[model samples]
Target: MKFTRTANANWKGTGMEGTGTISTQSTTLNNAQLSFKTRFAEGVGTNPEELIAAAHSGCFTMQLSFLLTEAGFIPEDLNTKAKVTLEDGTITLIQLELEGKVPGISEEQFQELAQKAKAICPISKLLNTEITLSTTLTA
Candidate 1:
């Protein structure tokens, strides 16, 4: 199962004064110098880091839900947010937070499922960064 999405950037000049397009659709065009950069989440344009975080969070939550269902439990609600922090010009995925509710499941069981899902999820696999995280389950 090989999956892929492509984004290419063409920078005509230096770091701050360059511009690029992600994908051929021109749906996402950016110029760092002009501050015309469009955020991936806003869907107003293109930003690579936002895109990466969105992908990670989306994939992880889906994987968690499926795994929980396979474990004979269904989540009442599942919400996960992943933060990809770029600090001092170095990018690091610093934290992840998962909050959810599952009926008739022990905290231990919930944690077991969460750990399994986190470890095996495609986004988690793609990440080489260490995660400082927390998860909460209730009801």
Candidate 2:
């Protein structure tokens, strides 16, 4: 399946001093504010890194869920957090932390499936940086 999604950003003034608003096609983020303060400093808005983290986490978790179903294991809960690290104006690493509770699945199987999801998820594939995964299979 091939599809496309888009978000729009509008900025005014210089990069350090300029402010912008981002609006997604789905309207989940309609005219959300973003600026230098939001990206590099503390501010009440969203930033690019945060958005990427959200996307990565969501994508990885969904891919894992699909793999689990395919493997005949039903997941009770799966929580994932993606951390995108930016240093020196370059994205350095992305860390994915996952906690999962699945019935009738060995820890080894869970880890293997999560590793596959990390490698195959669309966002994971799109990122051109180091990616790490830590998984916790819970009872």
Candidate 3:
């Protein structure tokens, strides 16, 4: 199966001084404000790296859930945080931290499944930067 999702960005003025708004098809971020200040420094509104982190975390969590179910484990909770590192105008790395509670699964099994999910998640595949994952399996 194939599908497409899109977001639109409208910008004005020069790169350093310009501001923009991003609207997604789902309207979850309708007309969200973004600008150079938001991207490079702490400011009001969102930025591209923040968006990518959200997407990666969500995607990896969902993929892990699927894999857990397929392996006959029911997950009580799966929390993931993605950290995107941008350096010198390039995305250097993405680190995924996962805390999971799955009944009847060993820590090793959980770690293995999380690794598989990280490698196979759509967002992980789409990114061209180094990806590292740390997993915590809890009761």
Better of 1 and 2 by TM-score: 2
Instruction: Write down the lDDT of every candidate, Cα atoms only.
Output: 0.71, 0.97, 0.96
Whole-model lDDT, model 3: 0.96
Full candidate order by lDDT, most accurate first: 2, 3, 1
Model 3: residues with Cα > 4 Å off, grouped in runs: none
Better structure of 2 and 3 per lDDT:
2
lDDT of 2 by residue, 1-139 (tens): 8989999999999999999999999999999999999999899999999999999999999999999999999999999989999999899999999999998999999999999999999999999999999999999
Model 1: ten consecutive residues of lowest lDDT: 32-41
- Positional deviation of 96 in candidate 3, in angstroms? 0.2
**Candidate 1 local lDDT, 25-96, one digit each (tens):** 344433322213453223345566666777778888899899889989988999988888866656666577
lDDT string, candidate 3, 23-134, tens digits: 9999999999999999999899999999999999999999999999999999999999999999999999999999999999998899899999999999999999999999
How many clashes in each candidate?
Answer: 0, 0, 0
Candidate 3: Cα lDDT at 39? 98
What C-alpha lDDT, on a 0 to 100 scale, does residue 17 get in candidate 1? 46
TM-score of each: 0.74, 0.98, 0.98
